[model samples]
Target: MRQMPPENPFDDDKLKEECGVFGVVGVADAANFIALGLHALQHRGQEAGGIVTYDPEAGFNSARRFGYVRDNFTSQKVMETLPGEVGIGHVRYSTAGSKGATAIRDVQPFFGEFSMGGAAIAHNGNITNAEALKRELIDRGSIFQSSSDSECIIHLMARSLQRNIPERMKDALRRVEGAFSVVAMTRTKLIGVRDPRGVRPLVLGKVGEKGYALSSETCALDIIGAEFVREIEPGEMVVISNGVVESFHPFERTASRFCIFEHVYFSRPDSILGGRSVYETRRQIGVELAREAPVDADLVCPVPDSGTPAAIGFSHESGIPYGMGIIRNQYMGRTFIEPSEQIRNMGVRLKLNVNRALIRGKRIILVDDSVVRGTTSQKIKDMLLDAGAAEVHFRIASPPTMWPCFYGVDTPDRDKLLAANMTVDEMCAHLDVDSLQFITLDGLYRAAGVPEGRDANAPKYCDACFSGEYPVVPSDMIAKGFEMKTAAE
Candidate 1:
């Protein structure tokens, strides 16, 4: 069902950053490699970024700052200040900590100091049982600092047995649920792990003698000139030391149901998830959408960057001419701050301006990957109509989002989702569009290269945001640990 989006209403339907992490070891420039990898995976987050490097002589050196990777991290002094042969980095979008309310503590590469030496860790997902675990730890007298779920893992590691690093990590990992693709750097080793269901993407790569780089997307490897190895198998722990990589499966294996949203929205188009090029797959989503909903559109105009490839495919299959309608003013959008309702609205307007000449008096089919808040979609569609579009037909490449994410996405409460309360016809009328359609779940599965029952384990996807089958249930779905603590303080 589709409900019309309000011009300024809240929506939890938008795709969100799942978080990005990367680590490298035994290289002369591990710090640089990590920074580059983080840049490639920048789409994963923009709220905060950091890198933690390990050196025998100086111990661990960490540099992090809140904001976009280019804006805060890798600044001239930051890059000069960071150095080591082994390190880990993260690009984060805070779901809890209030805007500009976070300190260095909130940023990741949360370091753990214990009897077995220390380790610097970077995480790429949310913890489902965070509140319960934090409460339990608080009862045991664990001092909480930041409201980040990633910090929970650090405290868990600090309390684990001191025998071996891998054993300690595994001990803590087995207790956490939801989605996670973690990378950690001990004084001597780099380690990576994925949840049993593989709800998030993590890949292992080799770059010369340094040999290993672990990242949320394979495109990070391309940024650093590393050769792509296979994915870090779900439910497995990978330890890379002395230019050698080994795997250990301590947790029971589960079905390989990778998060389908990665292909539809989260990942970099150039990146490869589950061994498929994200750019190519998104285009296929468009081709499939065209076959499913053959609309009478004079021209196809993509929503911009992420929507472009699929728009091309829709144009390819539907015989409609593909034209660039929205040109993102990246320079402006990147710097625009959204601390209030008015600013967020003004920011969106300034971010993209419709081409009156192309859209005016034309039957336009606007192809977008997904409609999260529908705020942006409604505004954009209206912008086209204001530019004199004869008629606007909306084509979404994915199913409507009905559930909030427990993994990592900062989905608003369920009630805030546009798809939650409205049907497609209702939504079309609400948005005042000429017509609307969404790709079927079956079509979404096919776009991922999962052909029917052929692969056996094929088509298993996390459509929690669409079907509401949450992979893991967080104890308190509404707990704003990050903000709740602030008010208490």
Candidate 2:
């Protein structure tokens, strides 16, 4: 067994990536490679991890565990049980299913046995029409296994009249609405697909002359040294069989509205997308924030780790010297208990500490990627003030996240979001900061490489969290009387 690190204690005040999927074909130890790929994507989802491998001699083998990928997928004993030349893996943070022990049954790669052969699917993103489709499928006499919306695809594919698994998958997706990036495997083929609107991310990569891989991000490809071929275009499906790749476009073409949050926080900074580095994009976002909301401060201090890169950019742009005013305690585990109100109030201090020497008597600008619940920010401010910091300003890289994400990102409901319920000045008072300002929506688009700015009539990307313009109707939410822009309005 591999050594287990402490669970992440830092409950970030930001959106969480729901899942990551990976698949490989034409490799001797495909499960092994997939394990590494999933390890690289642990940031996407840390609650659970699983792998499904297909061996010519033993058929399909699966292993799922409710913890970090390193703890479950690494051991030689575990790898020995899953010998195969084709495999798929998934890391999940639970969007569609329950978070109890029963959740293991909902883990991917979800398997289906067709008349022709068996296929396993690893999916990322939520299906907006899942509940409606589930009801319809149940009425039509389909027995569901897990509550996950992803399982709806299996049921849909089972009912498809298409000639093969890939065609059947295409048929299944056509009937569903919402964001999805799927990696699937069969006895002889590996398949990858992205939603029509490209609300989620998927990439195609080559592993030397013999193998090909499909992954949620290029960072996964980099882990095993796979050369990224290209992003799987929105609405496109690619099938890899017998070491050859075939592309199919079954859905009507639409402007790609890839999730902007992926660049902001979901994806690893080292990963590249649309020929641009995610790290550089975030740094540019910081630069844009500095230009739009410069402040009079003695030091620019990052919240830590995720905010570090952007803070560097802010320092350069604002000509404010950056300092490590806050230091994170790496060994802290997520399982800390706050038994009382007083202990709960000290929760932020468990993960972070104020650097008294660096921040005392200095007006510090705290750079963070986004603010979700003002809880952590409020605590951080109190800590800095207690450390004798003269003033605490906040510079957020992204615009106020006023809307909830309906795709894959795990956003709190609108009422729970700090921005959704409060105005800028109200938020500053809530966070107890000297001043608080977020990068403008237009500035964020420019940093993401859209220089002309967002087109209100036809927005290019999913800024639903900021602009309340959803690319796809959230069917489940709509059924519950949830108006799209009502909160923002």
Candidate 3:
């Protein structure tokens, strides 16, 4: 049996985004550019990273390592081994297969050889129908490599009767369900695709004179000095070679439902999504939150990093002075080692500290992105009170995460979710905070530039984590006895 790695003691109580993908074609030493792109996307997946490049002489070369991209992919020796003009990479925190015990084989940019040619693919979404497909493939005598649902695509492609690699990819994806934004490469071409729902994100960028890149976010494109071209449309595929691009629509069309949480937390504030600035959207979320749930406090402080933008908006909208009442230790990485039980007990203090002088005698309004299990929130409240703060009010930027996301994010099961189990008042009491509130679902949609707010029959974006209205049914989970919301409930 595989043993799970010990959970990070200082892990924040928030949903984790699963992975990010980047690929470069028509560039010299493409692996180097891919490394920089992946570094910009490190926040999407910090546990492991992999890069694959193909050289005429070297054929296909790959390097997958467990750790941050800066720690593993920056070595000159490693880059030299992957010499090629076309390459693709992935940074991953597993939402499928293996979980905490991620093996190197489970790392992506998974390569497969076809009768027509060879290809490498890095996927950034969950496949809902994976188990059923895996079983069918196994029964047909396909040898499995890694435990990832993503590998099922490789097997499916291998079994395709299409005349070329690109066609085979379409054939494979046509049979897949749920969200996906894939970056893939063949010997001479780089390909990008988004599922019909557009539940995840993928963008095209132009690099130098002839090079083109595809990335999970435009922020990754910025690292390589690539000009943002446009997003890969939902149900669309683009193949690029020698500076030329070809477009294909392989799947049936549907209304796009890009993940809305990317604006709240998953994406970097600098990124552009759906032609709107992610930073501006998050700041607006705070503005709306202030309007919907106003609280009087001596100081408005953010939980640091993720909450900073929203806190700024909240402060501006509410006329409250903003202060750094809670300070985060910037040098602390998620992989920080805790050797003993005594050290482990230090918990959140290892990564955050209360500003004793500033917090003394102040009534604080703490702004955070979301509360998953409530462990971190309770600890932060205790820290504030210990530092002589008179009162602490909690304001969350997003609506309460009441449902688990089956579309690439690593969310806790519903039973473990704090909001799924408690009402707002109960949660406030549980955390021992003076007050607690979350941004309303309609407010969130408004902040994302939907002026009319969410429609009951047709949502503009994927807000399943908050509203429990999943666009794609999670067949695998349902088979495991997981219950979904009923209409009458």
Score each candidate by Cα lDDT: 0.80, 0.88, 0.92
Candidate 1: tens digits of C-alpha lDDT, residues 1-489: 012222222223366674799999888867888889998988888767889998777788988887677666656777766777899999977664434444567788888887878888888878877777888888988998877778888888778875977888999998897788899989889999998988899998888865688999888899899999889988988999998888899888777667888999898898888778889899999998999988997989998777898898899989999998777766663444444767655545666788888888999999998876577788888889989999999999888876677778767666677887788888888888999999888888888887661232343877777765555665556454311112232
What lDDT would candidate 1 get against the real structure? 0.80
Most accurate candidate by lDDT: 3
lDDT-based ranking: 3, 2, 1
lDDT (tens digit, per residue) of candidate 3 on 307-328: 9899999999999999988899
TM-score of each: 0.92, 0.96, 0.98
lDDT of 1 at 381: 87
Q: In candidate 2, where is summed lDDT lowest over 10 consecutive residues?
A: 1-10
| Candidate 3, backbone clash total | 0
| Candidate 3 clash pair list | none
**TM-score attained by model 2:** 0.96
Angstrom error of the Cα, residue 330, model 3: value is 1.3
